[model samples]
Target: MATPRTRGAARAAAALAAGVLAVSLTACGGDDDGGDEDKSGGTGGTGTTVTLPRLDGESLEVAAVWTGTEQANFKKVLAEFEKRTGAKVTFVPAQDPIINFLGSKIAGGAPPDVAMLPQPGAIKQAVERNWAKPLGAGAQAELAKNYSPGWQDIGKVDGKQYGVYYKAANKSLIWYNTQVFENAGAAEPKTWDELLTTARTVYDSGVTPFSVGGADGWTLTDWFENVYLSQAGPEKYDQLAKHEIKWTDPSVKEALTTLAEIWGKKDYVAGGASGALQTEFPASVTQTFTGGDQPKAGMVYEGDFVQVNIGETKAKVGTDAKVFPFPAVGDAPPVVSGGDAAVILRDSEAAQALATFLASPDAARVQAKLGGYLSPNKSVPDSAYPNEVQREMAKALIDAGDDFRFDMSDQAPQAFGGTPGKGEWKALQDFLKNPEDVAGTQAKLEADAAAAYGN
Candidate 1:
């Protein structure tokens, strides 16, 4: 769902903003030594290990939407698997809503051995469509050893596990151009009202306050999720995500009304709503950091992965660019996350072996060393991250523990959440274009959501 780049000034800034924060021994990172202590792929936290089956001359295909640095880094992980088990693993690039991609492949009877499913609803869909296989005992054990229960549960359908989430994103973050804040004499806002005040301050200083990546419907979903997760709280968030509650709920309206406070104001967003609707995710981030002392926008919101796009600019991460958690809209700030899970699409001994390796901290360690990545594996050491900022961000996510919620849009069916220009994505995009139509927006959202949810 994110584009990538080579690590440079923007990369450093993005790395900082991406929450390359620290993780402690008690958090996701444990006290294990950096080296592989055992060939068994042992779990540091569980003190148990599993011997992976040797795949000798076997070949496997692993698919995901990752490209650029992300794909490059994951190949490093796959390379390690090849070296360890003598199996050849090929990386297959898939499209967004990967379920559709896999569906075509499955229809052609040429499915990859394994696929990375980005949305929980997609994993469920794969299982329902019989395109995904339940993980073998070996892979399941690895997940139990390293992953949090919440992470583990996300890959399950009807109580049977299918995916091993190998990549995670902290979606509730706003990365800003620090020079903009300094010039405007603004501090990071701690509350929703304060955020608006800061925006006003920035605007008064002759700068647009925020960049909304409205071209990508998913970005709009992220904005709504953060507000709804904070304003309405988790229980209702879960209900809405599951379609147990309709989009027309008062909580939904309240969040929309609150979001309109900023989005409704043409001056607050870069290029205004019409312009924002034309800005893609990469441009939304680059515009904030590219203009030196004066940029088109002061801030852009997304996951820590925004750093990848940030790398496209000349800004130094901690210096020219920085991040603050999404400002609190209710009693507490929201921590909405997203991740990609490795699921077996064509089950076999080799595929199961690949799944097991992905669940191990061994695999997570490989990518963690590369910048702009986060892992939910509790056993990977803090030292695995290249720097302190990543460790700090990692620490924040791991620290959230039970308070954490996965991205709400990702929890819904792809037709509603993942699809571009449809369902919540399209409805929210329309809402962004016309923030004053709260009732109209709510009705449209309800209609799309009901159709998507089959309710």
Candidate 2:
């Protein structure tokens, strides 16, 4: 989601873009399975690698919401960039709420050479405000070589490319404790009905079937978006995000009602609705692993970034943790995804060089090797990741092709999509708390949508 600090703040952005939030790695443990050198780079449709000009005597500062292992991993990539070009690059951690900080920096005429924005809306906003610069030739060449058309489209505003998505997260995943599933004799659900049946089986096994992170409302939005995408399809999803359709539309009601089958089920969800309404994202993961006073939550739905939060728990990933793509509700399962879209805010040779470097398969390969970093660059290989789970998730994301949808709320305005206690987040919260009031929730949602989008 956008500008999420791991800041897990995708909820705070009102997150995400959840990539306005983070990725599909670490859901399984990092195995350091240093098998063979990845050969997926330098192929496919883009066919041209953008090579940046060597910077033997220059320095640049870049900003992103990364720290700890994530920061170190990116730094390793940057270090390689520095080594290859002799440019000294300084990595600055963006503030918890990055938009305001970035705006202030721009106003002061000191924006970083490049800023990694996780939210698609944020990138679009920057393009609209004329704060972003179009990609230079080197960057454009890399985009042509490495990224898919859909990803290329994500960074565009009015046909001008102003951003590059270096990192990605598959938001269409459900992470579960393996032991819980094995105990319930549950297999991964391929269809929504199957999912509900599995939930019942899991509940019958004396475990909470799902962990709803109602406290962090974005998680709830993810629940709604996935169902909406599969139920209503991508064209409608984009139309709604752009305010081409009202939230009160029947399709929305259908999606929300479908959600109620699970949300409304008592004990099917860990801690019940009230308890979930208070559990933030971190607690959602911890509780799934910990189970607190109840049997463990059999499954928790989140992007691959959930792996980091899972790391905070005692359970081992891959061995103890497992994941499945979010099940299909309609004719097709939805491939909803998001990532950190890096946009150049200041136009300079240094900025252009950094942007170009970031767009290349080489730069992506460096971080992909470290785990938790998924690249939209089509050429990057499955083996670039450290583990099989991540490798598979990466492949699924790529295979979804142009049919993929970025996180819905993340593609809308922050006031409508990313704020706290306002707009979609609050409306979805009300729905979670009172699933029987479907019509009432629809009205509230539309009213909020109108206010936020000024429709």
Worst 10 residues of 2 by lDDT: 12-21
For model 1, residues 392-437, the per-residue Cα lDDT tens digits are: 7776666555347788889899998999878898999999888999
Per-candidate alpha-carbon RMSD to the true structure? 7.6, 7.4
Q: What is the TM-score of each candidate against the true structure?
A: 0.88, 0.85
Question: Candidate 2, overall lDDT?
Answer: 0.77
Total clashing pairs for each candidate:
14, 21
In model 1, the Cα lDDT at residue 129 comes to: 91
Cα lDDT of model 2 by residue, 10-107, tens digit: 12112222221133223335564646556554432112244556788898888987776688889987887887778999998886346666888888
Q: After superposition, how far is residue 314 of candidate 1 from its true place, in Å?
A: 2.4
